[model samples]
Target: MASGDLAVGVVCLSQTVVGLMGNVSLLYHYLFLYFTGCRPRSTDLIVVHLIIANFLSLLSRGVPQTMAAFGSTLFLNDIGCKLVFYVHRVGRGVSISTTCLLSVFQVITISPRNSRWGELKEKAPRYTGFAIFLCWLPYMLVNIICLMYITGKWGNTNSTIKKDLGYCSGEGNNEISVSLCVPMLSMPDVFCVGLMLWASSSMVFILFRHQQRVQHIHKNDLSPRSSPESRATHSILVLVSMFVSSYILSCLLQVCIVFMDNPNILAVNASALISVCFPTLCPFILMSRVSREPRLSFAWIKITKSPKPIINM
Candidate 1:
């Protein structure tokens, strides 16, 4: 109601709007070029999947929260509440699944043959869909309870609204929010996030080992071409790190907010929202390694030394 509160709300809402649009645009361009204009390359498919995941997350969470923050009205009714939270919760959970699949697929693709790890690579595609399906199925079930509970009830003098709109449980009830629903759904949340954490850790460790081995392999005789496999791992690993880092930090902030009972909500939202920007940064990180002129020079020299490739193209 105060001027200061309105100012804070505007600033926080603006950050989410700008970050979401910028990242989505960057990712869309990359996906367009990769899928249609550019050559069919090795990492192209995986990157496309990553773009889809982040884009979904953006639309689901970023858009709803941004609208609520900026718009004159809140979730107008129960249906609106369910719509916003469902998109936010379901899409958020999907990110964990998508990241985990991205990690495992990278590991399997890069694993040395003759090792047990190689077996997984053979079955990668079949398992990827199954993993994504399993990740989504539980969220769907658990959030059914949430759908019933999360009504767009108004706040009063006795209880409070954090910013403008009110979510259910403003007037908290032990049996409803905590005892019956939160406890039940939290079980699945823990399992899903924990599995993702374990998978991400394993993937990161394996990536480091692979990178170290490659260090020794790099030499005069080693060709100018970098292993496209390692490059894929690098991009996915950056994505995982960015997601995990921002997520863990936000989780910590959430815990502190619980204990401290601070009125601030926007900071927590901003932190999580920034996590969406990782998709935009993903291509730039990959492109940092790709040299435009050197690639051009390589093509020129390749033609000069051997012109047959030009005729083939």
Candidate 2:
């Protein structure tokens, strides 16, 4: 391998390790909370599942890509390729779905008492449970095509086949199947992105009205203290923005790679690195809002303040 490839390999390794650690930390901390008899909120439940999805994405995609960077591109077998790619796609879908669910829950939680969604607040837990359950089914179904298409072959002859390193090109005979699956792969993601945008915009409107009410009540105070719901909404908005930004950058780079007659290896690696960043950086973004005061003797156990009053609607 070239020195540049080695450097890229090292960087990929570092990202995988860091992402795994962050997701694992969040998962362990929440499981500990469960063991200690503290009730985890609905948001916490969604976060727990999101962390799992992130961890799986890192394992199934990031680790393999890092290995490929180190010149192990052909190490995987057909079955391994299918499984890894399937899990990676599903994990990504789940992460998107869970984030959308979280945003919608936050919007409902903070809506005005007479608003339509606000009345649904009391049933949030049940709805959350249902949504979480529903999130996995479509993703799992959509990626089933991987089993038939993905293979581990070095020089695949089919021009129409999609080539993922360490995986074989998808078979071309099933063009119709591929066409149907294409929409399945992306429709849910587009839908979730739409939901996130809607929720965040609604949040800003609610916050504006709230600020107006507060200003009317206290004429002298220009900087009204933000409610926890507002803070949570802001945090969710930032996270969604980060997710969308990373996805768009990665997609643009990928399109560039496809058009280039001879795409550089380092450029491809950079695209791979950028693609998985949402899972890698999300936990730290969340940790930024956590309380710094130590709540436990254990070094890893930083107790974050509870989310806004979600139950009151």
Candidate 3:
């Protein structure tokens, strides 16, 4: 193997390992809380879902891609190809949906008593369970088309077009599938992105009002640590920004993967490297956010009481 390929393989391996460990640690932490009779907070449930999706995504996409990068060609079969791509897409969709739900849930949690969404805050726990459960339907349905067309390179042979030997390729005359599948796959994402942005905007407004109140009440005590709400607001904002940026970058790379007829190994390697960052970084980001406040930090709060109450609404 070339030094460059070895380097890429090393990076992919490291990312997959780190991401899996981080997410698994978080999962274990939450499950421990639940098993000990500590009632898991609604936000804990959401975090669990997010962690599951990211872990699966890393496994399906990162593991196989890493193996391939390291010169393993075992996944040249139709079933393996189908399974890898299917899991990756489904996990990606679930990750996006749960994130948007998280943003909306947090926004509702912080709603003013007089606000229309104030009533929603109380029922958010139930709604979160429902939302995360239902979010899989659209993504699952859309990716079903993948089983029909996506397969090993041999299955991609057609009279008009040739397929890449390096990656799974779909049927040649798949215009109908492309027309239907692309929109089905993307529509949920578009809607989720919109919802996340709307919630983030509302959060910004609330934070502004909160800041005004804080300044008026304690003008001399300008420390940011005085308010856990501000710390949470900052954390969520950072999470939202990171998720959006990573999601957009992945989408663009996928577009390139789809449109580029003669993609070189370098392009493929670059895409794989960039794609893993979101899942790899997400758990650490959550850890960092949870560390900001002691009372609400992950340290003192067991399963019973979450410091920030992310899903209170």
Better of 1 and 3 by lDDT: 3
lDDT of 3 by residue, 166-192 (tens): 456555545676678777778889999
TM-score for candidate 1: 0.68
1 or 3, greater by TM-score:
3
Query: What lDDT does each candidate get?
Result: 0.56, 0.75, 0.75
lDDT of 2 at 256: 62
Better of 1 and 2 by lDDT: 2
RMSD of 3: 5.7
Worst 10 residues of 2 by lDDT: 293-302
Give RMSD to native, each candidate: 6.2, 6.7, 5.7
Clashing residue pair totals per candidate (backbone < 3 A): 0, 1, 1
Residue ranges of candidate 3 with Cα displaced over 4 Å: 153-161, 165-167, 222-226, 292-313
Q: How would you order the candidates by TM-score, starting with the best?
A: 3, 2, 1
Local error of candidate 2 at residue 78 (angstroms): 0.4
In candidate 3, how many Å is residue 291 off? 3.6
